[model samples]
Target: TWSTDGVINEYCEPCEAIVEGELVEVPPLEEREEFSLDGVTYEAFNTSGGLGTLAETLKGKVRTLNYRTIRYPGHAAIMKALLNDLGLRHRRDVLKDIFESALPATLQ
Candidate 1:
């Protein structure tokens, strides 16, 4: 039987077509602060699960929402070193297909 009735998750809200708007990304920190590194910098990149439409709807109501691009802590550094320093996003589609073909999916 085909049905759209049992699709949306517990936290999901039917927003004004999540397709129409650009993804909403909010940094994890509620308060914005400045930081010092090699060059003067401020804390901005934060991580949160932007699983589909989660962040887009929570705008303003919640101080912060999960960022889509940035990773948390070591994740950002590691991924940057791999994806940027080494470069991987370019061939991601091929890698994804290979990985999917090699590893079998398990249903819980």
Candidate 2:
């Protein structure tokens, strides 16, 4: 998603590089009014697969059903800024080129 959406310019040996570091605790969420247009609107958090699975089952039974994407809150904003504000969407090709050049495919 990051690559396709232009949020990330590349993919590296994620499982290896990331797993090498010790797990770090993220600090608590601080309320920020700037993060929202309406307080009710939220980035879909922990709802990605739920929506996919429930979609058909609740199709005609419900008029309004919404599922949020599984995200770590601030992730959406960072992504939105990367994809929308940074104009990466328009420069996906160059972004991909840079990413592919940097990231390793696999290790033996």
- Against the reference, the lDDT scores of all candidates come to 0.38, 0.39
Model 2 lDDT per residue over 42-103, tens place: 44422122333454565555554443343435665664464468765467676566556876
Candidate 2: 10-residue stretch with minimal lDDT: 11-20
How many pairs collide in each candidate, listed in order? 1, 3
Give TM per candidate. Answer: 0.35, 0.35
| Per-prediction CA RMSD (Å) | 11.7, 14.9
Residue 90, candidate 2: Cα error in Å is 3.1
Look at candidate 1 and tell me the lDDT of residue 24.
Answer: 44
Model 2 CA deviation exceeding 4 Å by range: 1-57, 94-108
